[model samples]
Target chain A: MLQNFIFNYIDCPGIQSKNAGKVSTCAGCPNQSVCSLSSTKLANPEIVLVHKRLSLVKYKIIILSGKGGVGKSTITSLISRTIASENENKNVAILDIDICGPSQPRVLGALGEQVHQSASGWSPVYIEDNLSLMSIGFLLNNSSDAIIWRGPKKNGIIKQFLSEVDWGSLDYLILDTPPGTSDEHMSAATYLKEADITGAIIVTTPQEVALIDVRKEIDFCKKVNIPILGLIENMNIFICPKCKNSAEIFPALTGGAKQMSEDLNVELLGCLPLDPLLARCCDEGKNALIEIPNSPAILILKTIVQSNNFQLYIFLFSVSSLYKFNNINYLKLYQEYF
Target chain B: MLESVKHVFLVLSGKGGVGKSTVSSQVALALKESGFKVGLLDIDLCGPSIPYLLDLEVEDVHQSSEGWVPVFADSEQKLAVMSIGFLLKNRNDSIVWRGPKKTSMIKQFLTDVVWQDIDYLIIDTPPGTSDEHITVMENLRNVKCDGAIVITTPQAVSVDDVLKEITFCRKTGIPIVGIVENMSGFVCPSCSECTNIFSSNGGVSLSEMVNVPFITKVPIDPTIGKLELRGHSILKMYPDSEMSKAFSKIVLEITKSKEA
Candidate 1:
């Protein structure tokens, strides 16, 4: 049945036939067995539990990229912050699944905040009235201690992050994934298999080296059947705050994200310029979009969230319009709603 | 696995995109240029930029009865390179692995790869003193590491991270090979005039404060990125370039330290 679907429906250029050799997409595809190739492990029951836990959340969006230091965590934080600021009463949670480099704590301004475990599960640290956060960084003894567990242990914690976390009826759950498409991406996609992901926002810099890796990241998404929400070209240019003259800090040798997105057939969500104030905000563990309200980066992010076709935006819009729950027992309201 | 290897120099940085991989690949190439058998192992399981920087992306590892054989830099040189990038399903696919899987992969890269008798082994590690660094340090406990060369940009943020990296090496008992202040200044492409972009001498001041050898300052060369994009060695692309000269000086200093 899968082979038939591959031969007839799937238009992947790499997939010549059902019996053809495994291509790049085939390695991560759920239907790899239809092509008679075996590499990654198939999904199991833990995903079902993850779905049950995540079902309370209205939308799940993952921020991904092939290259590191492309401001993925920052984007995720910005998106969550933007969504939350739009409605003071709406509930939003950002899950920092970037295990190795859990910069969300630093980025989200929740550093040194501890994750408290009750009989129910681990409770996320509340950052604002509407925004809450869960991260492995919260479980660490210190910021510097290395998280050295292998696959099984890491999988255990990821499962725990999904199934055990008391997320409690969030309007949106923004997952900040680590750079690359290997374990965390696979695990998150697998666990949330039942719960439909809004899509992945692939971030990249305006550099050929960075864009080259992002292309493969797109391919990974295609293979795994993860819907590509759009591609965000971050740090595209450095706009001088003084003279307002623009400079290309990391110049694109080849046409960067815009050209690559056109080639890959993905939506170019928005391009964010390098703002010094924004960088300082991130360093100081403050909300960049909120701190510098008129910053171009924040404006671009707001436009992406407020996009006409974006379902999450509509969902958030409708929720805020219906309920004026701002500070009036918001946790209780969430409990009552769920 | 690298018992036959004479010296191991681990290239590390506290922060990402500080040109740790660039320094690693060039140092290995520089050593090979000096007629020494060198092997570059990229233990940065998360972001293996070594293979990409070295232009060995398509080369697959050959497994023998003994172990996995690393790809040679060129037929003319004795530089062998191994990175997790080569093992990916695609160039853009993320490794997405956790700590344990990454450590295992690092261990396999160290012990399983057929690294024969070589003069120097340069291991390019991922940024941060996290799981990957801990795993490499624990696994290579038996091997004789010459020291670690921490690469950093001439920025306070980058320099601060390098201090943490220095602390990690000290805590783990790894010798400090010295620090390379990469992108110390911007060298004009047309005029060859130098400009302090992130403010030069941050690394020098850091070295002085930390009490470690300050290796060499590699200026920002625009061609370095263009050359890396084309998968060519910087030294081979622009041998007389200021960046190549800086790397050569650093290599000379490293070798002199090793001998001493």
Candidate 2:
């Protein structure tokens, strides 16, 4: 549909010359090495276009993990749900950059809906009244079909999702990166540099092995200059069916969530207990937040949202208060540190 | 003169428990010994091991008017070293900085640190092409360097997974200077016959296939492990050891290729 829409109105040469030519022309050009514009365009065309449209949106948050089966998608879905639920009018878009394992659509229950392309760009499938969603799963002919793509091919498709899609205005664009800090994560980070990422939220289990790999992910974020928002411990505990009581399935031996946050000085967002109902809802393509109402998991999600909102409020308050005081020294210090 | 500095070599690997830190440390020492004023920056935020490997402690890092001074090797070669380990109060204390904070710190290390009069800045990255590796590539690109060195073992799985890191460097336009096969073969205690326990020659094959130079093979030695456990480097423990000789040879190859 996006391809069809582009073909109908805009000539390929014109749009290509504006964006694509800047990228292709850089090839073998002496200025290619230091060319930020060309590299940014080639890395992520969608993010570049989005920047032009909405200059107000400051940061893009990407949630990533190393090993699969670590509940990264679940954490992504919860974060998006939390952000949209708390902020009434703020527009939030969940872009699933995980082409192979496109679970955001299923987790958020936006499957079977096709992303429509308009004259401006491609529109994301609405998850709720406020939240918009786009995923490779939504565009797939069959949900179970294997993508079987190499790095470059996958990078191109992700670019198309970002550029061709009409995201309009957004306060936050949370990207659900494929497990492992591999090709997709690199491409997303490089392309979305202009978005000035707030930071990444790393999701992991409480096991030692998982923590080991998760540490690497955390270190990776640090190395790349992506501020770490925090760590979310998924399946921190499990509730007993017979007694309806919570028990720590995997003992928090490493104090993983606390230690990681303390060591990294990032926020430990919150932890979610293992719930059968939540898992079933995700499998059945239902919203986990809606299915498990008044649940501990939902409570945790609410708390994280509140904390993030509180942090933002403090940030804005400090800036405005500084203006009122008109203290040049404090202003200079704030500018330097922040 | 500063703008003329090209090729930042960051040594990295995916599989941990491998001697990635040691390889990176030795590379810096060798390069410095070879007359290149190298800045050995340890970007492993969580586990900053370079300081310990080089026998430098937190107290040794002095603050001068220029900036926080790097811990130097005893030799006149003057290998400038910066690490998170040096900044901490205790060597065992954990780094509690979050993602954004860590990124900022790395940027500070690159831009803020007074790394003047250096030809090669060898960045010793943490294992895996995670955020840390990306940060090095991103920040160093701002500095504009020559390439990177990917360190791996002779194991089949290591060779396979390390290629992912190689591909990452290539994607970012960081040239592959070469790959070093660390812990390639084990020497028998009795006969001293080299045994292919993890399958030797895998590194050579992988380098040839990847079309990068097979720098050299470093044999596994118990003495090196003992030295490491004691927080000593091979260059110090056994200056005339085979492993040290191999490292020196690799450094020569790297410098030659860079000049070429």
Candidate 3:
């Protein structure tokens, strides 16, 4: 594990690596010349700094989906808000690592907010005294401007978000990632590799198309050694508001998440049906519990937070990689998630 | 080299899983059924859902003297398809490449694919701004493209992300063909009543705000969601359904806008 560690940073062989420059991975890598050198490996200052910052964070949970628009950001917002409101004493923060399309700022209703750099680092924008957020949205001049960058540039910001963001100290830090297991996912996994990442909550819509990506995302988590906390199937059914006739908006031709979860051996945390009022809350950036008091989706979200898997895993997480949703920091996870 | 492609447009969205592939597949099929030689480029390399949606998942691309021969959806070869999903060793073998590999793959798909003499090329991208978007924009900079068909659901978050997508298109020089509000509502088959289950009209307001054409609002059509109809294009499969009609209208708007 130690030998394979460091994600070889940018898939490079690192400075002084025996396979540097000559390996197929370095074919187009710009740092081939610099990385090909043979010498004693100097400890990366950035990794050391990131470790320093994240050490203060008790529980680190990343929200991921191999597919887009599966409600990862929405779930992150709902869970974080619920946790912050419920556990007033604990600190909770969200790190939006979706460089191209950061959703946390808007989802948390802090879209136009700015990040302030203190002597410590960039202070996260506060939503509540206990809950704050750090997203690229706050840095953009206009929320609508495209962050048209390639992999390396995106990785740079993600690193900044991790090492530079001043969360002070957080009981929970939920990182929201964009769709696909590419640069952003790689960057997050690499930086947070040794950050004692709690586990990831995988979000997906109940359908074969979305499930296909969910499977790949699961594969990614396993490859990166990030424990799979559980799988969340969002928008499972749509009940007509008038007739109350429920229909699968996205038909599970291939058995959807239930079959996939069973096959992948990952926990199926809870299923949230598609509700219009809840959708309205996400769009309006309002708390679903407050806005749609009787919403069924809220009921499911509650179940997921209280789900024994989520609670039980926090404690067992660091003990063994054999388990999923493992070693959850129950108190902190309860503070950040519940 | 894409002299065969007369007009190239992209199926883009700010958020993922909002049916960018669904729209791209149906629109490509609609154009093909209308007798236009269409090419569908699935540049959403990582999550290449187009092959599965279009039921061409089993088809494989072959190398030809012209370049890579695209798999045809129909027997007549009117609809040509290229995607990273096709090059996979197996069905579940995900493309685990980072930005560089994905960027190079998109470039290869653009330059190596032999979409000889196509009327319209629809590039279906993965949601959000990334290397795939940049590579496609840089490569297609010289090509004559009709612009992009931006898709979204009737939700605020999707609209928010799509605004960034619109800005991305503007900065990259791709014009906006229109905004499509997809998965807007659900129509119960038994009750025959419509419910704004996903909310409503987020795309229309977005179009108005961005000053792009308002294409069409496609409801959540369950008929098309059936597993058996996975590879069947909505236009030919459910030609009489409300969803099919919306797709046809979308095609009408695209052609109309291009002509104008």
Candidate 4:
């Protein structure tokens, strides 16, 4: 069923598909399987396998906020649904790195679904036809249970999510990070150094208090050389339905989303208006994108997806080199054999 | 030559829950009382409790064309204070800054703010030698530094860590004036005898081993906790308290050492 879905939905170029089969030999190769293929040999076979593995995957864009209650996970879900809906062929994967606040599964309404794992690796539970979902919440015995882990333990779990999880041929992998520039963000950023970070999307409210800290998060990403793709202002404005007019729920202060992006030299992606229904959908474990399709929050995500296409393309091409392999022409071989 | 401005002294500890901030605040307050212009800068970005300790309100942060101005607790005290906690919208709001942001803010707090012609600036640094600590140490190196006071408890772990902290200061060319042992001993609630709760004399022994001056041991007192919980600095709350007396002695030692 999964293979049929992949074949029908994912558009695999013929040359790439042929090359992938040639690189599949590394699955049986002992050295390439255990250690990184880079350590074993510089041969085309190793390169092909590595490339194939990476190409079959997509660029992982992790949205991280320096602190909590910043609506980071909600933004993650919005981006996932938006990108998935925009590109029908692309498989959008959402991995919630907030082990303690595992809300992705719940937000996507995939809570209580068992994450199936085998000798191969752990597989993400499907949210929709095009979106695959995984979170620390899914593997737990109980969803409400807390994850009491130190830095090293969290790092190990993150590693498993990246290398061990069977995220086959993804277009974009969105990781929703827990708040604070602490253990989780550091671990994810450091571990996935090689993975093309389509970039970080910093979420902040219009209030000076949130911006002060959000500015810090922006500076951190800059220091680490992680491209600040954009700054998103969540809860920028509120519109009253009866009045048919929009009002600034939080008073617009200086050094807000626009000022911050200008000062920091990052793109101001867009702002999300204050929508109670959008919040309610998230609270009710429904996709905010589907629940509030006509909402401005969805519009902002759609714009980000459109603007970040160039980056997404470059990320995909870079990972494509990992899968190229030499193959003998079977038709010619068959004629020669005959 | 006439001294234009008194040098800044930053008191830091290598571990948490060591009363480093408490000591720095009191020392600053004491210097203010001694007729010197003093400024207390709290660089503990995440857990900034300086405002609460000094009993200053948020509206006290005066702003000018120059930038945000530090607040003053008392006119006679003449102490200018600034904390990230004060800049925050709410008191309980957590500061979730990355290393670079913390560094930037620290730099701004030092250079951008209109500190005026202050005599002594006592900086309270967060525990551990993380990026924030490094930023304070590095920036202060460029500035005029009088000396640094290393604080610790009478426990071996804290003593060992503080010695390494002292070594760090020494390596960075920051002069170590002295060491103060906080919670050195617990004064009996019933009897007048002092109990060696954390094993007394560790501060003296460590100071002797490191060849730095052993300032004084601030005994554990129930009133200290009460005053602290009330966001009151010990110097302001209990002017004649034993801890205040010990801190004043240390301040005297620092001034005498600097003069020499």
Candidate 5:
């Protein structure tokens, strides 16, 4: 349902753009080496389909963390659930492109749910009436089965997830990516370059090792020109339920995310503590906002979504007028890094 | 380094930030502490934390007649280390390489890298089962791959990913040596009381579900970070700590012969 002319081809010089490797717009593009000769040469054939399918989505937010296990899927699930619950009228969906270790189905409590296929496309499993989730988890025979795929196979699956899933007229499409700036991240970025990407929300723990990877992730975003919304520091501290005290679980040796954000000049949205209750709720796939409404982690998340100062609340059911959607000016500042 | 290296244990995880590199370093250090020559090959090229974890100084990969020479972690030249971390001109250089580049790099690492006949080669992989993992498995298909030691945290999310990893091991024919549940609980520095901040037994249940050996549970000890920061021997300096004891148990199990 995308307008055929929405995709502006000024940046890319078509398929025969001499060498895509030399083009700044083609940097970090998965098709940098092989730009297939096809329809109009505006983009790749699959990417054109991707644009056609995802043009209905208003905001496409990517949840990325170069370092894994820092709660990328957890935060994506929570945000989609929160957005859907906060606004009853809006339609929100999560597209989990983590082909190898897709956990969105399990995280959203929709494990073992099958994605039905109609004439249009594959239907994402509905976690709630307005909130739906799609992942390779739903397609596997067993939830425990491994997807032992190499690069091309993984890229194929990612394309199907982006263009084939019938995420009909979504207000927000949150994409949960795998760790590292590898196949999945590049494919998603390249295919969705012109999909009116709202921005990316980078997640990380407070540890220096984790932050080091996060810096790589920032570089990747700049190389791909994905405008970053801000950074969310996850698992900042561990608060004990029994002793009523807190501890530095990962121990931010190098001033943690705060210092990194200050040095890198990226917006620090807020920090969420390591709450046991929230972990238990996520383990059971229960709604954190409902199960542990008063927990510190949820309170911080609520503040992030409710506060007007920070940018997270802007993605919420805010007014449509104050808009500077993919301002190319911001990406130019990081072009030197590319 | 020994003349006849025996075991090559791959410390793996399905999710990131679950301390895969830390666990790999601990296991390798434990083997070295036990007087076994060890070679730690860190294939997590994107974020090779091994050099930092082992407190290795920034050094170049010198190409010898055999292949690239690995750096030594100890003065005794017992523990050898190779990582993409050492090849970078700048430590902050982001490895934004694609799959083909990564696969070729990994192939070069496996074919090259003068391990010098160490008793063990611990390959620390990046999270997930992608090209890097497949390339590793394919290249090691001919070798006597000992087994894989899977690492997971107590969180259900981590447990969920571990299940898929177990499947990957099963499909790849890598015997599951055991599973180590890392960061099971946080020990308050002041009160010394442990709390299940991540919720315990997820690793235990995962191991049980897959019928793999549940190695041990490592709790949150901030001192481990200090040891890692100072590049101190994890098992040697913190032998009395709970983490050291847990890894000692893991090393014991992973080092056992297949016939045993």
Candidate 6:
């Protein structure tokens, strides 16, 4: 939409230019047809800039869930932490797009980290040597103060995050979106049109109620052409520490994530049991993936990250880099990480 | 917009998934069971869980000469239930609505729905004090709300957010009915043992600090969770359950305050 405005602002060559032998600048411009006011307009300049900025990132994986409080943010944190830990030298960034409820800053222990804006762009707060984050939470003066902006304003901030933030050459740009297939989701897909969106990972609780909504989230991804990497069932069960036995907290009383995935023909990524330690870790701003390395849920997340398609893509990326740089070290690095 | 309803109770919470919808559903059901004509409006635009919490199917809203007809729940009491969930064509079709669209939908839910004369209208709102809260408060400015019932768990994380909800209510001039600390303890299903899962007394201390009444602490009943997943209200299934009694007591406190 912004592209049309920029396209129209360019002065169009009139009939005089047509008669003359001179070639107008508009004639050579890639967006000439769009500038001519054709219905099939050119890509918005802002979106193009967003794509250029995001193309530096290897994968843009969005964490989405239709139901709120379904652990989307936790999954985003877990995945990023796991990847950043494994690929120690690789750059990883998380763009917390949950404008209304930006939990990433506090969850990552980067709360109150001021975002520094330079001539290039806004610099994301580094949570680790290789991992950084950008969130609306950092922009707010007070954590308690609510962001009451409407759809347009929220979209603008998301756009600014995509185009303005200098996330230089990230291996993974994990986008933690708000619940529901609403404004934030739409903006992410629209603005990151040219970015390599590896796909979406839909998170849900192991309850029929949450599964129903998560099914819609998967459907939304299909409609928007954002491939669903898989469905994750969070709070699948509660394991009693004393008895060492698993208990059903919010189970699939009436056809949960497993059944829902079967019915919808989507892959069930894994079920994460309700771990009290994990909750405590998140509340205390600790990394569960690192703190609880043997966590069954974290193991499952690692498996999802090492799926065939993801591995193949990473392999190909390393191979390509090796060829481009005429170096074998990149391949060795990838092999070592894998 | 809701002249026929004598009282309005806007149930809210600052944190999501703290059983605000559950409280709203049970409170409405308890009031209806108490022989009051009730209408439950699920105004949670993005995640409309009232229908699911009540085990409602994807039913269509019929239009009559009066207005859009609220769905009649198959219950003994006269209860009118409406939710944005019902308007969806498919279960997985997400409502990608924005602020203006959500505001208009809320306006329609308030103005266009034919909620017949009722003793109480229980409005279920989404979590947080954002656009939805502001819209509901502004729209119901002329139609006075009896008060708002804030729901929260016993975790400091949740209580922190609920405190914001209390502050928002104070600033907006909405009367604070009380705060209900839900999921205060886990009532062991196998053994009747109570365990403080997320810590206790967070809600009570918060209410004391804010000078508002602490309504009741609803323990995390595993049966209640299962029943909700199965789309059945624990009140109707297990009327004498502790959770049901807690909801009934909260409803009594709300109605009694109205009489006072």
Instruction: Give me the runs in candidate 1 sitting further than 4 Å from their true place.
Output: A1-49, A240-245, A311-338, B44-47, B58-69, B84-108, B111-117, B127-135, B152-172, B179-221, B228-253
In candidate 5, which residue pairs clash? A68-B16, A69-B16
For candidate 2, write residues B148-251 as lDDT tens digits.
77777765545644666676777777888788888665555545555454556767987987788878788866465333333334565578988988887777
**Candidate 6: misplaced stretches above 4 Å?**
A1-40, A306-338, B75-77, B191-196, B199-201, B208-211, B227-233
Q: Report the lDDT tens digits of candidate 4 across residue range B1-260.
A: 00334687888766454678678777887777777888888887765657766767454566789777888767654788888877877653555455667778888887766677777888897655555666777787667787888888765535644665676677668888888988776444434455554556778988998898888989866465343333444666677879878887878976786677
lDDT of 2 by residue, A250-335 (tens): 45555757776676565566788866566556655577677777778778767876774435523432332233332122323555
The C-alpha lDDT values of all candidates are 0.75, 0.65, 0.83, 0.66, 0.81, 0.77
Interface RMSD of each: 4.5, 14.9, 1.4, 18.8, 1.5, 2.4
Candidate 4 regions off by >4 Å? A1-55, A307-338, B1-260
Ranking by DockQ: 5, 3, 6, 1, 4, 2
Chain A of candidate 1 gets a TM-score of 0.78
Q: What TM-score, computed on C-alpha atoms, does each candidate reach?
A: 0.77, 0.48, 0.90, 0.49, 0.89, 0.86
Superposition TM-score, candidate 2 onto the true structure: 0.48
User: Which candidate achieves the best DockQ against the true structure?
Assistant: 5
lDDT of 4 by residue, A225-274 (tens): 56555677887765654454565544445546888676656667778776
- The positional error of residue B82 in candidate 2, measured at the CA in angstroms, is 32
- lDDT by residue for model 5 over B1-260, one digit each (tens)? 22245778899999888889998888888888888898999999888888888877476788998789889988998998999988988776678877899999999988878887788889999999878888999888878788999999988888888888888888889888899999888777778787887788889999888899898998877777774445566678867888888988888887775346
Task: Give per-residue lDDT, candidate 2, residue A43.
Answer: 33
Chain B TM-score by candidate, in order shown: 0.94, 0.87, 0.95, 0.90, 0.95, 0.94
Ranked candidates (TM-score, high to low): 3, 5, 6, 1, 4, 2
Tell me the docking grade of candidate 1: incorrect
A1-338 in candidate 3: lDDT tens per residue?
Answer: 44433444457765656787778767656666666655445556777778888987777889998899888988998888877877899899998888877877766778688888899899889988999999898999987888888899998988998999888768988888898888888888877876778788999998888887888888888878788778888989888777877888787778889999878788788899988787777767777778886788888898778666676765456444534543333435556875
Which parts of model 5 are misplaced by more than 4 Å? A1-15, A18-40, A309-338, B1-4, B227-229, B258-260
Q: Which structure among the candidates has the greatest TM-score?
A: 3
lDDT tens per residue, model 1, B124-207: 887666667888888788988889998887755456557767878888899997889987765444444555655568799989
DockQ of each: 0.21, 0.02, 0.69, 0.03, 0.71, 0.41
Worst 10 residues of 6 chain B by lDDT: B225-234
